[model samples]
Target: MDYDVVIVGASIGGCTAAILYGRAGLRVALLEKHRNIGTAKRLCGHFLLGRAQAPLQRLGLWDDMVATGAGTGDLSIRTEYGWTDRSRVDAPPFLNVRRTTLDPILRGRAAASGVDLLLGRTVTGQLTEGRRVTGVRARLLDGTEETHTGRLVVGADGYRSKVASLAGVPERFTPNGRAFFYTYYRNVRHTLPTPAVVWWNDRDWVVLGPTDGGLTEVAVMPAKDTLPPDLTDHAAYIERYVASLPDAPDLTRAERAAKVVIAPDYPLIRRHPVPAPGLALIGDAALTADPTPAPGCTWALLSGQWLADATAPALLAGDDPAAALRRYRRAHRAIEREHAFMRGDAEAGPPSAVQRLLREAAVHDPEVSRRLALVGMQVAPTTSLLNPALAARALLVRHRSRRRSAGRAGHAPAV
Candidate 1:
């Protein structure tokens, strides 16, 4: 093989994997479709939550990211009942930065760390030897073709990954009820208690946060029917959105930094754990939950690190990578458990009884609120919501609140 690893995509996930692979003394080739080094994802929430800390630190990017002027703060979410108090959350704070600045930093790190960065290269087909994937065939920007072979070919090209499609990866998609829109604003006031705030309701999920360059990104996920026919009038749309939610920041004085950008129509995607022999998939290429919460960025960084950790030793020892692939599959399934719940949430229309109860209880129960925030930040497993002790505490709080309401109603003056 010409290389030990050939990775498709050079975004955060791909760059992260390349950085790790190079660190492990492995020869790696990182391919990217875009030739521009400064290109950034325009339609993103860009909030790197608590879950992303581990991988960022392990990749030696914690301080570097902080140095990039990425805002650091905790997350506060509001449900219909009230704000899910994050005062009790002890996890590490999140980093908020735009992809414009973040992407180049990761890509630069990958190049400096000795990974072969192949830009303006598009993978058109996969190379298979017998029953296993061996490499990829690609088209160069200069109207030339090239074949890159590797012991392991990783498809990190994201949601509609050509590599996965070429490898015949099995995937499923669930329809989403929300239409997404995002834009940036200058002079936007920072929400209290930190860099970001999320408003979650059955009808909408809105996230607002400060990114680099003193601008704020507001991503809205309202019911498909709720959006107007013309989204070009961003101010009007944001005004209407603020009017609908409680305690939302007033963007009246904030100036629009650019035109509104509508997110691509995307359903919840889940691809098979192991796509093919000697081929691996990570980040959105493997699975994607509801985009309403903007969970893709966190998972992208994490899945890359997980793949590197699982397969590095095998590649170094000249052993079969299948066992390592199985380990990665297991790690992938662990996150799939969390994504499963998110998928159910996106398709289930509104919050069910349990979800409502949990959100309601979170308003008054600190522990419950903390756990809820952790899960929302993708730091905790969805199973944490099922803790018997925590559930019982939330249940008790709900019962008392109900009794108080009943007592007050009985004593109401004649009206």
Candidate 2:
């Protein structure tokens, strides 16, 4: 084997994996197709939720990330009901950084850890011994072919992962159910302080993410079918949509800091038969979700850490990596599957009965609001809201709030 581990795609997941593997004294090769090496993904705003706190702290990535003028603050969500009280929710702040700026930091850290950084190499095929994926064949920028073998091959490539295909990892996909659009707007001075806000409108969800370079990202995810006929005029429609949002930003005055990117919908895929013999998958290769909740970058980094945490020692100890790989797979499924189900329930239609109860309760009860914020910020699992005690509390709060409103209505002054 040319290396202990060969990682394809040098995004957050692949780079972090390479860093950890190399830090563990393992021979690692990190390959990316982008020759520039600082290229960033364009789909989402690339914010890291509270779930990222532990992983970033463990990997020691947050400080350097923050030092690079990355924005960090508690996320504020405003449903039709009302805004989540930012003061009451004390969870860790979300990390907001532009990928164009953040990618190099990861690359630097990965390089510093002694990982072989292979740029501009597109994986065309994978090598196999019997049924195990043992390596990858690649084509260079100059059209030169290169073959590299490793004890394990990791597919950290994005949503359209060629590595997964070559390793025969079949993908099970579902529609995101909403069309997405986002762009950075300059001079977006919100009332709040560097706040990350998501406003859920009647049929659309809008998020105003304030990130580096003093720019605010306004992203909208609306029902896929509700799109206007002339979707070509994205700027016009997007501006119209922004104006309709609650306390909307003045997009007409704000200059677009970036290009307007639109997607019909992203496919949701949580890998089914991954962790194949001598192969593993991380980041979007293993699972992908719509940008509605913006879980991509966080999951990518966490999955990389989890994979490295699980397999490094075993690889060094010369033990079968299956056990460690199994551990990683279970962890990934437990969290990602739960989150996916929650997202599915949400996007299937309007809020479900339980969702209604939670949202209503989040507005009334401080504790529920905090927990809900935690869940929304990805600090707590979505299932945490499913606790019987918590559900009862939410119901009780909603019930009391309704009663109080009814009483107030009955005693209201005549107009």
Candidate 3:
């Protein structure tokens, strides 16, 4: 084999995997279709929550990320009823950094780790032998075609991964029923207790968070049917939408620092069979939940680490890499299945009755609020909020509040 692993993308997941494989003394080929590996992804929210910290630390990038103006803060969510603030005492603070700053750092680290980084190369097709994927046929920027053979191939190219398509990975997609648009604003004041604030009003949702270089990322997700036809005037549309939101920051006071970014027409949830024979998939190639929750970067980093950990020993020892890949597939499914289910449900429509009850209960109950936030941040399982103890507490709180309201009505003067 010309290389041990041929990774299809140069983004966070692929770079992390490449770095790990290179550090283990395995030859790695990292390919990127883009000329500049550090180019910022337009549609990303770029908010890395608590769960991403451990992986960043393991990659020796925690302090560097912090130094790049990333700050730790809590999460605040506001619904039509009211607001709920959640701050976890035990978890690390969330890190908000733009992909422009974050991606380059990862790519640099991957190159320094001795991986062969190939830029401006498009993988046209895969090289397969019988039932197994062996490598890829790539076309260079100059229109030159080359076949690079490797022991294993990894598809980390993202939601519309060519590798996954060519390798015949089974995929399932669920529509989110919304479209997202975001842009950066400079000199915007941060008013929330948490660095991140999410507001849900009717069929509309907005998220605001601080990112590197003193810019605030403002993202809006509205029902697809509500989108205006003239999206070419992005600034006008975003400003008008923000102005309509109750208690939203005045965009007139802040300078628009970047072009408005829009998500391409694609489903919010995509699930694929993760591994087959000598082929493995990670990051968006394997599964993608709703981006409305801002879980993409965190999941990418985590999935990459998980795959590398599973396959490193096998590659180093000349053992069957297929066995390790299978283990990775199982572990990935086990960890992400429930999360994917919850995200799919969320994308389909408004909160369910139970979800609404929990959110309402969270307003008056700190523990409930914390658990909800943890689950949203992917630090805890969705079952945490569904536990008997928590459910009982929520019901009791509702019962008490109802009784108090009834008593007040009984003693009150006629309106």
Candidate 4:
């Protein structure tokens, strides 16, 4: 094999995987289609939540990321009812950095850690041996084709991954029902409880946050079929809708930093069994859920770390890659199951009678609000969100509230 591991794509997930393997002294080939290092994908929001902090700290890049002058602020979520308003919450919150700035930093760090950076290279196909992937075939910048073999090949190529299709890994599709248009702006006093701002306008949503270089990143997600025709005049569109919404003026007429970028076609899918005989997929390639749950850079980093842990022993032993691949698949599925639970709950909504009662209680009760936050954040298991004890408490609260209302109406409580 030319390399111990060949990673397709050189963005956050691919580069992070390379960094971990390279640190393990594995010969790694990191391939990127784009010529430039740190080339940013326009559509991403670049929000890194608190959970992903531990992995960066482990990789020794946490301080470096902070030094990069990424946007620092409070993280808050707004529903039609109101913002979760957690700026007062005591915790080291999320960071919003531009992909262009942060990706290059991560890629550079990976190369410095001894991963071969194959920039300006397009991977065209894989070398398979009857159900086992052996390596990849790629085209170089000068149009030269090369075949690189590796014990393990990682398809961190993202949502539209050719590797997943070519390797015969089937992905489970989830209709996003929506798409997004985003751009950067300046001179917006968009302060929040944390660096990230997530606004849920019923089913539609919008987010605005600071990225690298003090530019505020703005994105509006609407149902795919309902997008406005003229994105060139995005500000005018935003102004008409956001002006009346509470705390949304920051998004209406902010100074423009760049032209609007529209992603009216990114569908969400969750790929199952993220590994094969010699290949493993990570990041968006592994499992993609709705952005409403805020799975972005943080999830990518976390998944990359998972790939590293799963394959480290195999790389060390220089043995058949199947062992590593199996472990990788199992670990990836475990993480996916965790996210799957959240995704399922999101799709179902609070539909059951118990859930409806709890939601109504949460609207007025502080304790219920905390529990709601836990479920929304995926901090608690899906089952925990519907715990019998919690449900009983909610039912009790609902009963009390109804009795009080009836008393105010000068009528006996209805049976």
Candidate 5:
């Protein structure tokens, strides 16, 4: 084997995994199809929430990221009714940096950690022996084909992963029933001091975040049924939508920093066979949920770290690699499954009565708001909100609010 591990993508997950493996004294080949490893993805909000900070710090890149003009601020979510202020959580503020700036830092760290960073190469096929994947055949930009063998092959590619397909991994997808459109703006003043602000208006969702290089990212996800006829004219549509928000900044006052990018649809894709003999998957290649919540990047970073931690000992000891891979598969599924369920429920339909009650309760209850914030930041499991104590408090608050409304209306409260 030419290396201990071969990763198919150079995005956050792949690069992070490569760095860890390399640091563990194993040979790693980090392959990227793009000519430049630092190329910014066309359609990413590029906001790294509080959960990602620890990983960045562990990689010794947190200070570098901060030095590269990363901004930190609280998170605010506004609904049709009102805003949910979650800045009281003890967690660190979200890190907002452009992919253009962040990716280079990650790639540079991976390279420094002794990873064989291979850019401008596309993985054409996998090398397999019986049921085990052994390596990959890649073609460079110059049309030169090279084969790199490895003990394990990891697919950290995005949603449409070729590795997952070639590895025969089974996948199931649920349409999120919405499309995302976003663009960057320079010199636009925002209403909130937070790094990111999410507005939920009449079933439509909009996100605004300040990223590196003095640019503010404005993204929108409109329901499928409400999609505009001129989808191709993204700028016009984005402008109109942003302007229509109650307290949104005027896009006309700022210079359009980038071309508008649209993801026509976001389907929740889950790869069933996450691990097989000598093969594993991470990032979007493993599971993808609705991007409306902006958990993709954080999950990507965490998945890479988890996989590396689980497999490093086995890979270093020359033991049965399947054991480590299996552990990774189990952990990945558990963490991702919970997140997927929550994300699916949020996107499946409008908020249910209980969900609305919780949201309203969060506005008035500090503990409930903190719990909601923790879940939103991916620092706590979704089940935390459903604890018996919290549920009872929420119910009590809901009952009181209803009773108060009835009293003001000069009517008796219902039983």
Candidate 6:
């Protein structure tokens, strides 16, 4: 039987697309290369922001997520000297969930939404006629090759997407200069004020949060070459660094929960036109960037819903594939460009002097702290930081603080 849409890679992105399309009455075949549909990657931070809430609510998965023992709360960011905690305002509360628990739940929901699950199938290549993609050639677990035809083929496969390569789409590349190391531990202490915290030192950073069942998820992000062989060495480095800061909490008492896992955190990239004619790519296959802007669950849900919204109308209009694909491409680029600008100069070292000054100011002022939180979350644009008025204010605050310290010393502080 021919499907309206055949999606490769049954990840959050693929599953989401399948759920959306199937619910719209389209027959969708969602393929997973893995033998088990319930499997999940071990190295995710497992934190979801407000933007991810829309898709979950739309798909009726919010309650189920909570039912599955996910933590619902605000996210907090910690820099060298302080913490900024912001609760959900006019958005769904952020969720703390292990990917192992989350992915399988989402996959089950996608199946219930009418997606045909084709687990243990490797999509080897694409079936394209000239510039128009028509179907896929996949090899099943039993060593049998099958051809599945579809009006539209959605490539939701990850970073190394074969479908995108087969379609001859211009490859989008991201800078993978940093690596992330993480592990989950049980009975870990949450002595920090918030469940989620980002500790920024001069040259390194760590993001930690509580997962299900008293397990704490610790993620260490450092330059690819900077981290010690064990990654745990950075834990000691963080302790020494944090102790020097004013009012920093003691983390030495917290027991190490699990062995560290390390992976690269790359720069963001997007293909200008994700879908052309008869093929479309969604999620990481379509666009991906560093996790700094926190792109896991939100990116998946947004891209998935986007593909569904863009193509459902065309499919209903009798296989108007080209028009639908064009719409999908346009929508993807629009969102990608916006995210690219706000993700910050990740290439730059730690926080800038100016940023540090503003953060110091935020410690005393709630509004300033909230703005800082927005910046950290990448919810606000970079222009906010570069604004002349804000930059001047940060400078003034910094200068005055230096003057006060100098006066106490009975001399000007050396710059």
The residue-by-residue lDDT of candidate 2 on 1-415, one tens digit each, is: 3989999999889998998999999999898898877877766667788888787777778898888777788677777787755557888888888888888878878888999999899999899988888899989999999888887789999888898888667777876778888888888756743378878665578888778888887788888778876678777778898788777677888888778888876778767425578898998888886677777888888889889999999999878788898888877875576556746743647777887777777777788889888877777788888899998888788888888887888854322
Candidates in order, TM-scores: namely 0.94, 0.94, 0.92, 0.86, 0.93, 0.86
lDDT per residue, candidate 4, 120-170, as tens digits?
889998998887888999998898999889888888888888889888787
The candidate that wins on lDDT is: 1
For every candidate, C-alpha RMSD to the true structure in Å = 2.4, 2.6, 2.8, 3.4, 2.2, 3.4
State in Å the error of residue 64, model 4: 2.1
4 against 5, candidate with superior TM-score:
5
Distance from true location, Cα of 43 in model 5, Å: 2.5
Instruction: Compute the lDDT of residue 83 as modeled in candidate 5.
Output: 71
TM-score for candidate 6: 0.86
lDDT of each: 0.83, 0.81, 0.80, 0.72, 0.82, 0.71
lDDT of prediction 2: 0.81
Please write out the lDDT profile of model 1 over residues 134-189, one tens digit for every residue: 99988999989899999999999988889989988888998887877788888876
Clashes, model 4: 8
Total backbone collisions for each predicted model: 0, 0, 0, 8, 0, 2
Model 6 lDDT tens row, 230-307: 645655655555455444455565666655565655656665445556788887777775765566567777888888
List the candidate 6 regions with Cα displacement exceeding 4 Å.
85-92, 229-252, 264-269, 272-275, 338-344, 348-350, 383-389, 392-415
| Model 5 local distance difference test score | 0.82
Answer with 1 or 4, whichever has the higher TM-score: 1
What's the true lDDT of residue 172 in model 5? Answer: 83
Model 5: per-residue Cα lDDT over 19-59, one tens digit each: 99999999999999998867866667777878888988898
